[model samples]
Target: MIKITEKSECCGCNACVQRCPKQCISMKEDEQGFLYPFVDTTSCIDCGLCEKVCPILNPFDTKEPLQVLAAKNKNEDQRLKSSSGGTFILLAEHIIKQGGVVFGARFDTNWEVEHCYAETIEELEPLMRSKYVQSKIGNTYKEAEQFLKDGRLVMFVGTSCQIAGLKRFLRKEYDNLLAVDFICHGVPSPGIWRKYLEEIKSSRSEAAGKNTVLSLSLKSVPVITGINFREKQQGGYGWKKYGFVVQAKSPSKGDKNSVLLSSIFNENIFMKGFLANLYLRPSCYKCKAKNGSANSDITIADFWGIQKSHPEFDDDKGVSVVFIHTCKGKGIIKELSSRLDLIDSNLKEATLPNPVYFRSCQEPKKYSLFWNIYKKTKSVHEAVNAATKLTFIDVIKIFLRRFYNKLRRTFKMVN
Candidate 1:
């Protein structure tokens, strides 16, 4: 019963697909590699359930958070492995200890991200850190609903739009369900992610020369064993200057040395393209879940400007900016206080350096240009360079803008 005339009308959350009792709606990928709902008109019974469960059509009202705080896990090793303050792991662990399930995004064997649930603390490892790609929500909503109906405590964490979709699909709220989201900086296309991985494998094979088994056969292609979007082991900047890392093993039967590839956030081709807003879904530019519209109980993100406001808490390791949106969220924070190093903070300071918390990322000027070049060259690196490289005029404009802002700030300080 739902119609998507424009790509921006849908967030590709897969809510409609699961909500349809007739199972008549299927998600089909477009040329841009983003999924859109395709209803089987002949089979659809017009139950109108699909329309009723669309987050975009029935968005929650924007509300201010009840509490804002800076928090980090007390466990240093866990913090190191996490993308931010490692707060999510603690939260997930708490739920698991209570014999509950935690749902989150994790990479599959093929390195594709998907929504999955974990019941044990050990199972929560894959759900840690960030995947950046828009994960396929394959029957996760239905699974979560089943768990909720079974009276099991459940914690669901994902991008805000995903949380919104799940909430919409469920319709009625469950007391035992805890919905958590992040300050999302638009999800990139999974199609582009697959392309980028292929590019990496091909380039690595060429770099290794003739003796490498990677060039032998399609089956001997290197298997990506691990991928870290926010590798915190960078020598100088620690968590603040996280790196992208990919680890792989050649299928040579005997050779076991793993190849490790890494790059800083700015230098990584895929990260560059993602940060520049080159290949994000069209709906990302006009996100319906911005400004607390997802109605999540708790939201978490990197405390980007913690050094300026709480320098003592900024040990160069990651810190989380947490927004408690409801009484349920506050209760959880209290329950976890002993395990977290919590520092009181205000929302204005928390959101100051993290604009994605309130506003969606604008599409880059070279968004179309990047796709055009990629379509022709099939090179992620080339496409990213074409989209992100600044010209002389652009550099000049950046300098002038910075100078103007500095001058205004100085004037206000003097007054």
Candidate 2:
């Protein structure tokens, strides 16, 4: 009975699939590579569980956070590896030390982002950093609930819709569960991601002057080691100017090559398309998971505009704006007080620049045009480039950056 007539009504949280009692619900990927629930008509029980658990249809009540603050991990190494402040790692580590399970998104060997769980400190490293694409939630909520039932502490981190789905799936609150949601700027289609990989592999094979069977079959695509969209490279980690660095494992058997794609966020095709809202899911344009209503125990996001209010905290590395929504969240922060540099801050001021926190993003006017190009060419790069256009000033800034870097190197050599 729970069918998605409109994509905007479904967040694609996969709760219906995992919560089906008859096991008749299956998640089928659409042309855009986003999974939606499909029920077998022959096995129609009409129990209404799916509809009841739908977060969008049956919303829950939530309260404003008790307090908000700006903080960063004292560990420099952790901070550098993180997209923003290392707040996620510190919180995850606390749960792991308490013998808890942590669930979040991570890129697998095939460079696909999916939700997975980790119980050890070592297992949590790959789970860190930001994966821009919408992650496939594959029965992770069921697993997290079981962990909570077993009297084990659980820390689940994801987008707001994801946390809402988990809460609905549990049907009740668990004292040991800590739900953490981030300020999401919408998710790009996984189809675009696959196409991007195909282009990269095809280009690489052509450059090598020979195509292997694996490359031809699209089986041996280069393994993505890491992806950083908010890289702190271009002078500082300011929101206006940031780097997109992607690291890939070498295709050759023993070559340990680190492929770095460092550029301003605007120059990167994927970032440009993403920021332009060219390929976001329809649900994102009218998201129901804003204004602290998702009931997440805690919320963490990049402390954008940190330099203006908290100059001392702005080290160009990263800083996190954290909101403690529940008493449990406050307790956890209190426990990690010594391990972090915390400063009390106004919630309104801290979240001023983050539009996603207050409102949904408007679809770009050229969204259809971009997708039309993608439909015809089947090229992620070509489609995104066609959809988004860089201004003349942006091009000039890019050129000046390259020239400055070259001049700096030359001067160093002369000295």
Candidate 3:
């Protein structure tokens, strides 16, 4: 049986739970809203399968990428809808066209992120974009294994830890399996996410001159129809400084779309807390799968410093920095070359702008303080504000930084 002595030891990948032949291991959410495996000692056979399949205990060796390149989907509309360069959609479509399945993180009806599989191109929409919250990987490892066993092509896209988990669970390699991981910047608490949505609904109701008290009731509250964590269509900023958008149907408007909340990523309250490293999963602070340790076929991430590195490629649209690790990854990229505008790039430039590619984020000093406040008030806003409130000097520094960045961009454009 496996035991989680420290929270950081578990990545909530659900591999141990699925690997347990006795089915004694269960994933339970902790106070921080991250899942950790719990073993039922009575039912556990002590076969040690759980420990055998743990990615953290037995991580893969880091390997140098075969090819590093910057790529963009040729389809302009698809590129705009995606959080990055829409490379994921291309990969998923490729697998689906080959009569395969694609597993990825997507939102449930209540907006809680979960790992699910899509079999067709139409089913791939929900799997697109970025869900910053840690997704519930409910038996996805087992599901993917089944598809692979059936000799069907299976593509699994998730954080590095998740890809590691799936590979560990399978115990062997599969020619039909394509594991794609991303440059992850920690996953935030789902509990905080739920609270944030409720707060947004309450605030919107009060603004609409409706009774805020009624918002407490699920039936009376407006239904959230859509949520885009990385809405790239901000007026001037576009993909460079994407917005966070939430759309809902108002009950008073007879289920019509009435509430649309939009804010730049930096301005959004939830995003502010997330980016500040307030309430990310414990494992995120000490990720063992960073820097190609997950042994994924391919890794994709936003080309954050594309403007500085490849000025001509910076169209204010999205660009993806792709690291092809295995020959399988190279083959797929070659197949999809016609559909993407590919540019040869080096790993140094990619990692320079995105340090999360190799290193885990430092745990914020106010991490404990934020949880303490949340425990008392149960308010995501109050906890985040209290924990991350900037001093007068901090505000001035931030303003100066933004001004400097703006001026530099302007100079680059003129040159």
For model 2, give the 10-residue run with minimal summed lDDT: 207-216
Writing each residue's lDDT as its tens digit, candidate 2 over 318-364 gives 89899999999999999999999999997787888886887899998
| TM per prediction | 0.94, 0.87, 0.92
- The worst-scoring run of ten residues by lDDT in candidate 3 lies at 205-214
Please report how far candidate 3 places residue 176 from its true position, in Å.
0.5
Residue lDDT tens for model 3, 382-410: 88888889889889999999999999999
* Global lDDT scores for all candidate models: 0.88, 0.83, 0.88
Displacement of residue 79 (Cα, Å) in model 1 is: 0.8
User: Would you give me the overall lDDT of model 3?
Assistant: 0.88
Question: In candidate 2, which residue pairs get closer than 3 Å at backbone N, Cα or C atoms, i.e. clash?
Answer: none
Summarize candidate 1's per-residue lDDT along 203-235 as a digit string, tens digits.
Answer: 633224432333434556667888988888743
